[model samples]
Target: MSETKFKDIANQITSRIEQGIYAAGAKLPPHRELANELGTTPATVSKAYKLLAELGRVESFVGRGTFVRDKSALNQVIQPQHQELDFNFSILQPCLVLNLNALTEAYTQAAETLSPTLLAYADDSGHSAHRAAGAIWLQKHGLQSASSENVLLTNGAQHALSLLVETLTEPGDTIAVEALTYPGILAIANLAGREVVGVNLDDDGLCPKHLRKVIKQHSPKLVICIPSHQNPTGITMSVSRRQAIADVIKASSTYLVEDDIYAFLNNTPIPAISDLLPQQSIYITSLSKAVSPAMRCGYIKAPDALLPVLAAHIRANIWLASPINFAAATGLIEQGTAFELASAQLREAEYRQTVAADILKDFYETASGFHIWLKLPEHWRVDRLVEEAKKRAILVSHGGYFSVGDTPNCVRLSLMSISSRDRFEEGLIQFAELLASKPMPFSDFLN
Candidate 1:
């Protein structure tokens, strides 16, 4: 371990981050692995990582590894609609164009009915009417047991996840998740100083056998899964598989957080995993994906026993989720317009999936709900492909960000972000070309 050399190592790593070779939220190589690559001792690499952490360039959790940090990563990965040039297949949101009229009408109706009571501080869970609306929304999707009394409100699914992670698990406790999962879940675990262990995923989603084995080995306090249109991978769990997983949870002492945000994207309603193990599941959903991200309306359907602590966390965090947003949400759900909007979005997704399938042809393999998990050619590494895509103003999500462990040679293309069908198709054609073409030397495209 060379003490003086660690500074140079830290600077070199910083340069890599700045150059986008090591993407934001990417897990850095293990100490010994990097040490071998750099021809240095593991101790020296650890010191360099520590220095980077102190400088706020990277973050290190207790049991989890180091990660590059950047606030703009979200904006960079999930671009806004105003950027017409960038073919952003990065943001996994519904096409905003489809919902504008309905959203405006809902909000306008909400404005007319706003009273002093609606504007005041709401209860911990939220206003009864809003909760009732969330219940209706959740029940329609899959969680038929949803009711106003058990639904808790939050800014969005992300907030609900954070709130639940805080309330249910302790720092340094192990949290099990799908091997390749939503980056947000990993982010929550890392920030909370909880250890994350990835269970292998199969075509049907999380492998029930592996999940049980991980639970036994790690003795995790919590397990989180995205049962519908899973992020990055786009694998929806089968109903029997969901029951198998629920049985795994039922046999274990751990609580399962079923993030079924994409449940609305399912053609036929598949009952939520939580529906099978009501006492052990925390189900979260939101209108953001189905309606508008600006709405910020989210719901958590928890067991009655966990309600008090979860609500207390909600109270401590933001007093309560604002009733103003929930007012619009309530109006939409009550009028039977929310389900209609979701159905329209689903149809749009179906059309987009066809467009993507036609353009990508053989390259398109994953079952898309709102995104395509296009496996890359062996010649094109995930990072290199992502970097090249960005160079062409064709932004795609790097597979590294979504991995709980190693990700396959793949990049996730969010099909719903780009507003124009023509622009969207053009981006896909370009991507298909990139996938077909072999990698060029770094010097070739530097200029």
Candidate 2:
């Protein structure tokens, strides 16, 4: 590696050390160890270590190892300033407005209604009543013809996704995802040993032209997208954009997986892409986003052709979704409490969105969902703002978390879970103060 690159790597290591992940007086890993982990050579690693030792950021004692030194006095000599900040804004937690009474009541009712035979192994698909209730529940959202045969309940969205990925593609196959997609999808792709290629997105969400290009280049086995209220960015794909993406999927023989976890609370409901190409699409929507995160219930809708394969995957992995959780969801659907709770959540989300807009009006963009995407001012970088906010006991998410094609000059603020309006404002004030202050150099904590 070039000297400049070597120093860059050294600086990164020093940053980690300062964060206390690599503690002072601890021996740095062997040259070969670091080299293998970073996919670099021992020579490059050794040179970086040598530079670090010469600068006294690390001390190499004879025969022992390199140790992080006390660099408080070395502030004048490239002592990177540390910024402490809180990170409450970027997370999509479902804590603030959850109605636990409704959830518990549903679970209790399901337990009471469970058949004596339910104690035995559940049907590989799900309970017949539960599936029927699930179909009825989805019908309210505009998806039709979903009978017990079409719905399969799973442990949760993540488990359902794992089964979908395992059943749909081979180990080395690739899938197309949004440039800035959910980390859960990323984790699943990594677990399946499948490649996840990124497609560019616009205000309407995923760009059809870019998706078409990626499909041709990678010929992915599946095209996965979260069309409604996307994670992180919280932007919904418009009807026209949704249809355009559907057209692209229908044109190709490839399958589509539409993650509609965020569909429940969206006031302006877009037609499920599954409706556009039911034969070639599989829809996974879960209650984890609305009713209760503790209520681990998710449903899958697939064409008749793929049901058996998906069922087999579920059977092999987890015999079936728990009868208890399925019963709870079914009871809630039957009693209409789940829908009520979902409506309340929508009201809460809109209120929070409005408050966030009111605070960041000048900086807000035309985006829907629960998060506010704020473009950082030219004078301020996201990392600095994050750290300053932390020191003031407020937190926000950096743009790096939701970036793919190009690094955006922005950050996302999740306003749903935070309870205190005053605290939220105080944090935002700290953030604004940091933005208005003379900027400091970036540090590890900001990320």
Candidate 3:
């Protein structure tokens, strides 16, 4: 076949994809079949498919034929409806609308002050000023041991967790985590080939007794805990509970990764558990939740002994997080804009929580955080409730995503995700109505 003919075939396929004639994730016809249909040689069809693969329009498996790539995985998860109807309660982010003005000003100033030093590649860890600003950010969130020398920069909290998992433990190693935790943590552990043993969680964040048992039984090389306003569960560690958990880790000599990303949500500062075992703990926090996720600034406060390895890993992985973003972050932190934004987000979260409590008063007990861990009615299963909510354009996180072992009959509703107060309240009321109604018995369909 002529080169022009093959190019035509690729363009034809692209048009089909765009027109939805070839659906997302649907496999294309066999090359020979498609060639016959298109009145072209098999070689021409193969070339067209190859071009599509190169352009990231489709993916080919060795055994399975070429299939159109899903446009965006996030769209499937977020399930966006029309603007007036969409109530996306699945995202765990601050009310982003609250920070746009500050972010605009900050980014404008960042563009104006782009020094060659700021634009250039940074030291493996980061620029000292950026690191010092990171220290200040962590210090505000309760990591008093933070300093330029001990703190390192990461793309975000997710990147920090990935880097730590990659650096500290080998593929076959074990790590203990909260029984119910963030899905991101589970993703990191699973992808890295690390065995995750779930320690029981009580009224407090992580149960020390169960943690000691998990340490004894699984012999995890590291223990990860979310100390403040933990994900999915909304539990914060009490000071005594923090010390007790620290004592257990101190006794076991197992390193603790304190993922206090939600620390700023606390009205009163809670002293970090990392402070109890400064040498053995790695505290992670970031501006993504409060200031602006687009900036992608995250901080890690590691022990002096661990700095070199962490810095080496950061260099090996990303060379260094873009100094440009850190430059912007430094301005925010040094000038106190970051803390002020965090405070604003806290107030927003509080208001949203109150709204949630008012709507879900009878069903849910606890409040105050970015999201709620709502236990469902005995008549409603979590999967069914989630399906029902999505049917009404109300997106919520299934509790199963956050559980390590047996999945729970609960859902996590992110209050701050839907910025419109009216829409958020409406969604909550709809969700409450759904909860009040029970699914019909399976026998009813048969009848």
Question: Among these predicted structures, which one has the highest lDDT?
Answer: 1
Q: Which residue pairs come into collision in candidate 2?
A: 85-390, 86-390, 86-395, 87-395, 89-414
Model 3, residue 288: C-alpha shift (Å): 1.1
Compute each candidate's TM-score over C-alphas.
0.85, 0.78, 0.82
Q: TM-score ranking from best to worst? A: 1, 3, 2
User: Model 3, which residues run further than 4 Å from truth?
Assistant: 1-84, 440-447
Q: List the candidate 2 regions with Cα displacement exceeding 4 Å.
A: 1-87, 95-98, 404-407, 441-447
Please identify which of the two predictions, 1 or 2, would achieve the higher TM-score against the true structure.
1
**Candidate whose TM-score is highest:** 1
Considering lDDT, where higher is better, how would the candidates rank from best to worst?
A: 1, 3, 2
Evaluated at residue 232, the lDDT of candidate 1 is 73
Off by over 4 Å in 1: 1-76, 79-82, 445-447
Tens digit of lDDT per residue, candidate 2, span 311-339? 88788888888888878888788888888
Model 2 scores a C-alpha lDDT of: 0.73
* Per-model CA lDDT versus the true structure: 0.86, 0.73, 0.83
As for TM-score, the candidate ahead, 2 or 3, is 3
lDDT of 3 at 158: 87
Q: Give the range of the ten consecutive residues with the poorest summed lDDT in model 3.
A: 71-80
Residue pairs in candidate 1 whose N, alpha carbon or C atoms collide under 3 angstroms: none
